[model samples]
Target: MTLVNTMEYNKDDLLDKVQEDAENLFRSGTYFCSEAVLQTINELLGKPYDENIVKLASGFPIGMGKAQCLCGAVSGGQMGLGIVYGRVEGEPMKDKMFDVSKKLHDYIIDEYKSTCCRVITRKWQGDDFKSPERKEHCITITGMVARWVANELIEDNKIQVGR
Candidate 1:
């Protein structure tokens, strides 16, 4: 645990919060998979960009508007990585941005066999997208992706745990 503002901040707690918030946000319909992940990470990072920065990830849900190409959660994870490692004017670019992005892709692919939304959700093909099982699966992925990014941030020292 690290002390922040005189309070003990536990890294494990932060990771749990990231996962819970991301899952709840999606379950509450406040945001889709991508938006939830984006929103959760942005807040975790202290809102570095504008409040509406999550808009950048809006179109990524449902595998790019139901096209079912890339996993929406993965897309959101990539955006989260960019928010931390993105290139800025007059600032040196972060090489870890590319490295982490690819790592996320590879991680998802390794776990799901493909990063495509349709592929990840293949077990729900005949079921309604809004079905509880399908929703739970997506919600689980959203939470996992958010936690993964938070863990990476902690490991990279980009975020001070117990902040």
Candidate 2:
């Protein structure tokens, strides 16, 4: 049996599936941006981790409950990283977790030009919570983050690429 890694699978197809799943979740309107991203990752991983983790991500949407802080998608991606690499005891994996988090954060910033929800949603939502544009913007962010996080997980061997 071969263990999967970055070079062992079709990375693009995996990313595409992540993106598609996230978009479907977004359109379902059953989850917030952050919840959607994290939930999708959980689903793709066959729920190896506690499925209840999805509830933990509920408060992250709309910039941490509309406080306009960190982008929910970014937060969700970091949370997904934690699901795979987070240490439950000792401090051995601490550095790895932080490193992966920073990488995910950088990826978000590079793609979205910012990691703040207020900034990214400014044009789409401004001060209007019910703006229709917010959904599309959040959906795009959710898909992008899901794909990036999945790639990171696969490359790090936290998730088997072909599984």
lDDT of each: 0.86, 0.79
Report the C-alpha lDDT of model 2 over 58-92, residue by residue, as the tens digit: 99998999898898888888888787778777657
Query: On a 0 to 1 TM-score scale, where does candidate 2 land against the true structure?
Result: 0.86
C-alpha lDDT of candidate 1 relative to the true structure: 0.86
Across residues 14-101, which tens digit of lDDT does each residue of candidate 1 receive?
8887899899999999999999998888888877777698899999998998889998999999999999898879988788888999
Q: Pick the candidate with the highest lDDT.
A: 1
> Against the true structure, whose TM-score is highest?
1
Off by over 4 Å in 2: 1-9, 125-127
Clashes of each: 0, 0
Estimate the TM-score of every prediction: 0.90, 0.86
Query: What TM-score does candidate 1 get on C-alpha atoms?
Result: 0.90
